[model samples]
Target: MPSISHKIQPCLWFDSQAEQAARYYTGIFPGSSISSVSLYTEAGQEIHGRPPGSVMVVAFELAGCRFTALNGGPIFKFTEAVSLIINCDNQDEIDYYWHHLGEGGDPAAQQCGWLKDKYGLSWQIVPAVISDMMRDTESGKAQRVMTALLRMRKIDFAELQRAYRG
Candidate 1:
């Protein structure tokens, strides 16, 4: 297969689990793999504080989207402000992601189909139908769908469809 290239990729910040996180993500998503890895050198020991040969960065692709994980110390942390969205085609796909990504995460953070993974990275496991429901501008179906969405942690596509019809 030809190599896939991306002009823009999201860089995830981690304290010391860049490689581990990359592996975990690749395992969860299909068509994913660790493309490359880079390690920190002793030349920047004073600034980086990490021992030489420690993992510095891992470039990975998940479901065809490229991402870079960097072990840049604990100066920054993942927040809910930015999240990756996984557009699922069915309830099975939604359930699979919710179970895997929501593992070891804060239960309270699971709302409106948004979940925090074990690595503290936020993800939105949304069904494709939600988009179609939300895009109906002529009818008030969009508002109804939003109301139904606001009431659940994990999205129920069937419920959203019912709401759209109402």
Candidate 2:
């Protein structure tokens, strides 16, 4: 068998909603899809001779990244230690995703930018110029932008630029 190149896979554990979540994610993002799904069966010896046919796993992709959702019976849950950062070009894009992803989610109060979805998934909705502002070598401009961003949950590009000017 040929060895596959290295790829990052985010393994997600769900009680039984892996498929539903996968479809929801694919719908929310462009260029996203759920590739495949595999179910489980009691092919081997069971705890008490139980029959097979339980959902074992679901493998899919979201925004070009592969993820595996396992039906592990709710032993674990998701946390904020890991999150997806989306860099947006405008408020419309930010609002669209923020609203969609946050359908059953939570908002972290960084208006215009940071929000935690109902699933406890943390996302950073930022503007395109943020990179330039943060990476700028000019200390004064960078400092100003940084200060402005520190106070915002949702990143506002216009305010960041105003801060950069100061």
Candidate 3:
């Protein structure tokens, strides 16, 4: 186990892919890694109903944000109501994240830069400027940008810029 500093972090529930999910997430983001892993022992066999030494939880960090993935069974699942938002710097950044995160994900779940990864985790990949553009309602540029955004699955930063300019 590595030394932990974060007092609180998002805990993600998984049926059996806690370690795999942690590795996958850490691989995608720079300055990220798995810090620790705890395993179920014979002490909890009656309740956990698993072989001893099975993975129970995995602690990881993505771009400095800490998260915990638990093999807590399939009683719960990820829904679109909760999502991770990645605010990108440019079109290239957007494209890079979209490609890496959306790969092997459900195609039908993508809309307006939002996607569901293979793990059924929802994510919104968008240019940071989109927030500024969408907030500029005083000039009505926000409406134009929103209209352009509605038509996109993987947001095109260039297109949003054009809509904002108009």
lDDT of 2 by residue, 74-131 (tens): 5687776767788788878877887798777865433446777765667777886777
Of the two candidates 1 and 2, the one with more favorable lDDT, higher being better, is 1
lDDT computed for candidate 2: 0.72
Estimate TM-scores for all models: 0.94, 0.80, 0.95
In order of lDDT, best first, we have 3, 1, 2
lDDT of each: 0.91, 0.72, 0.92
Candidate 2, residue 20: lDDT: 80
Give, for candidate 1, the lowest lDDT window spanning 10 residues. 1-10
> How would you order the candidates by TM-score, starting with the best?
3, 1, 2
lDDT of 1 by residue, 50-166 (tens): 998999999898988889999999999999999999999988999999998898888889999998988889999998767888998688999999999999999897888789999
Task: After superposing candidate 2 on the true structure, give the runs of residues whose Cα lies further than 4 Å from its correct spot.
Answer: 1-6, 43-51, 108-112
Model 1 has an lDDT value of 0.91
Writing each residue's lDDT as its tens digit, candidate 3 over 57-141 gives: 9988898899999998888999999999999999888988899989999999999999999999999999987778889898989
